[model samples]
Target: MKSHSLDLKSELLAANAMLRTVIDENPNIILMKDWDGKFLIGNRALADLYGTTPENLVGKDDGAFNPNTEQVDFFLKNVRSIMSQTETQVVLEESTNTTTGEVSYYQSIKKPITTADGKKQILVIANDVTELKRVQKRLEESERRLNYVLDATREGIWDWDIPTGIVTHNHRWCVIAGLDDNYLSHPLETFVGLLHPDDSADVKERLQSCLAGTAPYRSEHRICLENGSVFWVLDRGDVVERNDEGVPLRMVGSFVEVNDRKKTEQALAMQSQLLNAIFELSPDGFVSFDEARRVSYVSPAFKRMTGIDFSQVNGLDEVAFTDILVDLCLPTGKFRGFDALRKKRVTDKSGGREFIEVVHGGKRILEVGLRSSEASMVSQILYFRDVTHESEVDQMKSEFLSTAAHELRTPMASIYGFAEVLLTQELDAESSKEFLSIIFKQSGLMASILNELLDLARIEARRGKDFVFEVAHVQALIEETVHGFKQPSWREAPKLVLPVESLYIKADQKKVQQAFLNVLSNAYKYSTATSQVTIELITTPFAAGVGRRIGIRFIDQGIGMTPAQLERVFERFYRADTSGNIPGTGLGMSIVKEIIELHDGEIELSSNAGVGTTVTLWLPLIG
Candidate 1:
């Protein structure tokens, strides 16, 4: 019996030792309070919090240890609530002041306990939650600030889950699509369906390429909204989350509105295309240079006009280009340097027109325009056109007006002098008849001059537009023109030299006859009565590629003109015989020259001062 009691006592002491070990080494505040709010038990944590040993707070209330009355009262109130609760347990969040004057938060769980005497007591267990609460507050603040920034920028944010084909987008994403952002998760089709049909394929291809790692994740494409309006957006993203195998798992990106910028770019592109079309269609030459003065562009007309290989001339300095143009212009005698071009102003007021004469297949007068490109400040532009024919016509008109005035004055003076004498002075019948005859002759001369002038003007003005061009035997046309001069009163007729075979040529019958008549009349007027003008047919080269030309030669043995007078023979109303004895208007040779030129024929006249004159005419023969 004695050994049994000893074993029981030993077991009881072991159980009490384990209980003390658990209470003394606990990490939490473990304590108990009576219904009166006096402490019945205290652990090491509670003693440490109060800056005292567990024995010091064995039966003390919080008021005995804590100096702050509010904390003590709060602790007592929680204890009383737990003791009074009919329920099993109660939990409360409470605060306490430490010995270091730092306030820390705790989650306290309390339960009512019945002692052996059947009195109710409160048991409290508290856990520190100060650091956890502080971290949570900070995170909430950061999230709020981030959302604020995103909303302010109105950025459309998207998070795509690759494997699931699901997407989570922010409120702004739906707003951009003109939809309500009531839900967060959507199918990938929700966004993809909004792409314009024209851009859908390209966007898909780009996205697939990026997802496959063949290209970067960026795109600019057109997207259609719910309102049926299309907008341009620039989408950019990166693989934010990837699997362990290096495959993309998720992607996050943004969509930025770029419609205005895209419209501007399209406008510029259309303008560029139109500008190029204008350059291509223009008959005039165009050249442009960049900021470095390098040849940036050359039109097709410019290449043809200059006949310089653009490959060789492109990127050359302005001086080199000038040298090339000057060399091409050497035959035309209008060489100019780059300095001259630089000196010209490029404004509407100035027009910047400069004449550059160049001989390509023929003499060409270039009216070049210079201007700076407003689109690019450092660039320059040049526009050139061939104006050779226009310039020559203007000069011819001016000369005709001057010479006509001079030629008409002589006959008018003669008529006036003779008529004045007949009207004012008394004379015999024979003298009066002689004076009247002179007046009639002068009037007839004036009429002839006016008629010839009118004929030349009409022919030139029509310029073959109304002429009937036909293929006729060359020899027949010559014979027909010679027959008009076959009058019975002539001292000698021109000798017609014929070719054994017939030659055909394109010519107008009446104009050809008129041309030959002027030539024959000149031959007869300048030569003596017995002089014979021989006409001959011959062949010679026309131009570079044009085949043989038919030549008709008219040789005269009359008093010929000096070199000075010969040069002016084709001038309208310019007569070699300055003494008014010649009975012809000086417009005959000019008319003859114009008619020949209109037929695409050339005339050559060689004269000796007193010996004779030789006139040869060349016309292109028909095939």
Candidate 2:
């Protein structure tokens, strides 16, 4: 009996030792509280949490260990509820600070148990979950930030579960699609239905390609809204979540409205096409330069005018290109350097326009204008127009005014001097009559000059509008003009020789007769008394093409002009006879030239000083 009692005590000692080991080795805090919330049993883990030994914690309430009133109250309340059988078990979370000021979180479980003394005790179990809760809070904050960013951008966000065909989209997605909010959680088909019919197949194809791992999910397509309006969206996405087999299980993307940008691009394309057409078809020349001053465009007219093919010089720098232009068009001693001109134009605050004289195949005048606007490539545009004919007309006007002024002075001097001589003289009837007759003749001469000047002016003022044109025989016109020239006492009547019976021509008959009459008058005016003037009409073919011309030749043995005088005879107010003996205005030959040019014919005059003079007028023949 003594040996059995000793063995029982050893077994009890071993059981207590095993229980202590189990309690100390467990990671959870295990403890028991009486129904009144006082500690009755405490394990090593529980004592460690309270910063005390298990024996010190016995019979103590939560007030001894936890300074937080709310925590202590919560602990007592959970224990009391379990002890009263109001709850089978209580599970809760609590946070506390340790002695080292480190925060700790705990998940606690409490259950009621009946002791051998018939009193109820609450068993408590706690596990530390501070790190897990910290991580969870961080994930929540990150998700909130992501949502804020998506909302701030005002972009539609979408997530698709490929396997389930379920689509999840934010509120903004519904707004962009012009649909109700219920569409946010709809199937993928609902979203797909909003796509424009023309773009639906392409969108699906791109999506399928991405799913098949052939391409990334990115596309631009149009979507139709409920209001029957279409909007352009730039959709970009990638397979953010994938299965182990590289299959796309989910897709995330954003829908950005690209309608404005698309419209702008299309408008720019159309403008470019229109500008290209203008460049090809415009009659004037156009050359554009980028900010870098390289040749950006060259028009067809520019190519034709310069004979410098644009294809060969398209990329040439401005300096080199300007040099080529200067070499080709700038005449010696006339125009300034291109660089200086260009710099002046650029610096001028006023509208940058420049006029220049260029010697192309002949002489040419060009007007260059520079234009820049914000909408341009921030580039400079150069426009060129040829004004050579205008320039020549201006020069002719200047010369005509100077000559007319000089010619009027000579006639005025004669009239003024003769009239003064008659007014200041005291004489008999014969002398008075002689002086009056002289004055009357000079007055007649002045009247003739003024009438001729007026005639020429009127003809010029109304170019061909007042002229009556008709078809007439050239031979008859020449005969009538020659017959009207009266024989001078010094010269014989001119003989008319006709090579053809009838040479027909389209002409202003009255003007043609006036022109031929002027030619015959000049022949008689310059020839001597014994000289015989010959007028002959002949017809010839044009050398340039299949055309015919009738020629009228006036041959005279007269006081012909020298080479220098002959050159100036056709100039207004320039006479071949500077000796003041010839009774004629220099305007006759100039008028003859003008009339012939108006008829689209040419007048040629060849003369020798002592020999005879030959003047031939050529006119286009009628059919």
Candidate 3:
């Protein structure tokens, strides 16, 4: 009976120790406080939030640590109400750190509890939501800005599916075009039918030219309604999407009503305001020429796009203006089309030469268009549209397809060669099994490469939109990753040297774990059994700027890479040592880079030919 009593006491002590570890290790705050606002229980996280220890918070209330008495009173009032409740309640609670004055938000679940001593208290479990709140507020601000832009412009936005000849319009389109609310869908012919007889042919020609890529769609034409009503509108559009055959797949544009605007008292004021908004907000740059056909005004976007300021080019003729821009463009870009308008006056209403590609600084692709007439004041306008992203997308797609084909063919050839050898030759059981094994391994390698390619594609396309981001404690994540990691050749496990202070980040737990696992796996895979792999939290700044990232560095004493190999580490399907002994799909580092960059993080690596390699992942700290 005495021995049993001792064992029970031992079990009770063990349980208490486990409970303490659980409470303290949690990043979230957990605590219990009595109805009088005095603290009864506090975890390490809750104490740290107050810049104190748990023992110091045992009997103190908010007033003991918080200097903001009003905020403290408000908090205590809520605590009292929560303690008074009969059932559990959920609320979003906010707290401010007295030491740093940093505000934090939490989604807390508070439950009314009765302690073992018959004391009534409130138990709280709070998850950090400060980052989430910040993101939500930013989204709200962006939506408000978009609302103002759309409402202020009063333009009807429309998208056209060229292949299907279907048109979709914003709500404002109907009022501008004097259309009935009867149609759920409108065909391209519906819009074409509304064009005035005199203007219909010109409009068709412009649309055809835009579709053919000979000219951009910009026309002011009269619209004829069914009731014999006529109105004028500014119609502008661009082919936003195209297929591999260079055929347009989709076009998006806008319509602005200008019917009888010349007679309105507010016409000049409205046009001036709209023009100012365009010059300020539009991503496309514009350069205006006066009656003398000299560079008179340069939009802000023009300066940003071409680095040519109005002050520098004001009162300059066409020849001088083109010279400045041509200097910024490559000689091979065939930017000489602007010479067509060098001699023409501002009143020359003919179609200025269509878009001629101008490669800016050999990095950006700009499509330049010239118009002889814009407004009465501005006689000639030069428009510049940056097509760099579109151009890169095309190049990327081409490279992806070609690279995938070349990489996949190697494994397929092995599979085919091995199967052919097995079928044609009369082999013993051992040889047949070896051949079959070879085939199976190659097939598995192919699957891995395909899966990696798909993952890379999905990541690039969505750009972290599908990520479920949350507060991720780095130490716990690394421990979890290393605990499950293993390799046949790696005799020793990777050693972890972590910081004493907690390091936290907003991350997708699974993705970050995958990234850690990949890095650790590479460290072990490339190294010999006796080689050591070490991981530690680096407190130093990885980059310069405010809110710089913290590094989680992994160092491996393995067969390192040469400088040439290191340069291509993040290239898809690149292997430092392609010798089949070091097995890999070669896409691991590339995938790691894409994942890190999408998370607003960076990966830095250094290696020597005979020495070892060190990889550091720089991630933004949140808590």
Candidate 4:
């Protein structure tokens, strides 16, 4: 009996030590319940959680601490479940207090506790999961909202598991594809089969490219519905996940029906193409100019006629080609020659005439006359023919007439000689002197007419002459030209203005001087006697990629030409109605244009009928 009592004491001590360790080390709310649902043992955690001590909790019904009826019932149910199964386990939800009136969530599990003699009690283990449960509820709400939005918008959402070729579609996605709920479970190929046959290959290629990571997965294609109707859909997707090797593992995307919008766009594109065709195919040259007189559009005929490509000429100001027109017109100051030809509405005939002279392959050619429309305020269309041969023939006719007049003058001279011999026999000294003076004057007039005819012929034939290029000081050129014009021959004295210093330009000196002289002379001749012809020399920067250029402007308060006259001012032999009896060869402006162009510079002319005219020149500045 003594040995048995010692053994019993040792066993009891060990049990107490084990219980103490569990109470100290266990984080859970450990407790023991009897078959009557009375708490027999409780750990420190359980006591603290329930606002009681372990000793106070002993032999107390759970109702002593767990005041909540649902919690008590839950505990009882778990205890009963464990006891009935002899080792059954169950989870129970319970609320416990941490501070006054502060409740927390907990999950409790109870299991059967077997005694050494095989009788059963209950052991319950509880864990805190309040924060976890709250987070879970939040996530569920967010998902619900997202799903509601997608459904409301009718966007067909889908997910694809690339490795397994499995696709899941939302209800709307299935409905859009003319499928039922089972569509989510179907193979992805099922949807591909619904694509229009003509688009199937392209769709497959795009999808494969996306899967291979070569391109983004996006496409619009027509889908054939169950009822044999078709609709266009815009599908967009990107890989959402990748494997270790960077291969696509999953993709999520959405589809939207765009049949109506696509159809409308197609129709509009067709109409635009039709309009463009009509504009391109029209026989007449079509052009549009902006307010700045820059060429906005030019048709094919315009390009062909001018030997200027639209691509090269577009965006260039109309005044930029003043030199080109002048070269063609080959005009004198008073009557400039034609520069180009155009077909005119001459009593229903489509005949064209050439205007100006042009150099082609080192030979001069004249452009025939052509009709032009004067409807546009800043632009005109010209139609003309090549009249180089015809002009030559006309020149030959003039030379023949001059020769005939010269031959007739000799016979008349002989008659005058014999008549003079008869008159000398009977005339007084004063009368003889007068008769001889008259005869000399008539001979001089004939000589002057012959000289003018020869000069005209030479000018017509020499239209294709090559120009000598040289570096010329633009400011000095103007000053020199103005100084020369200061001769008493000029009816009106004009004011000459120069830049502060000399500015050099790349051009032929003589030709440029001639051009300057012509313009100044015109200004002086046309201006009111009291009004000053302001020759202003100003320079400003131009866009030259690396640096800037110098621009020169000449402003004059002269008798400016009307719009009708300005339009034809650059034409060969073209003189304004106001230029009547003006002592000028219309070719002066034409030559000015040619010289400036040979220097690769630009000139612009702007004038109002009564206001004045402003001529601006742009030339590259020397380094």
Predicted model with the maximum TM-score: 3
234-325 per-residue lDDT for model 4 (tens digits): 88898889989998899889987766445444433433332243233222344444445566655564454455566765766645644454
Residue runs of model 2 more than 4 Å from their true location after superposition: 1-284, 301-350, 423-446, 458-463, 489-491, 541-546
Candidate ordering by TM-score (highest first): 3, 2, 1, 4
What ordering of candidates by lDDT runs from best to worst? 3, 1, 2, 4
Candidate 1 regions exceeding 4 Å error are: 1-256, 265-402, 425-433, 459-464, 486-488, 541-548
Q: What residue runs in model 4 are displaced by over 4 Å at the alpha carbon?
A: 1-466, 486-492, 544-552
TM-score against truth, every candidate: 0.48, 0.51, 0.52, 0.30
Tens digits of per-residue lDDT for model 2, 224-298: 988888867889887888888887789888987766545444433433432343344334576766557677667
Candidate 1 C-alpha lDDT tens digits along 412-473: 89889988888899999999999888888988988989999898878776776777889978
Each model's C-alpha lDDT? 0.69, 0.68, 0.72, 0.59
- Residue pairs of candidate 1 with colliding backbone atoms: none
Displacement of the residue 14 alpha carbon in candidate 2, Å: 95
RMSD of 1: 40.7
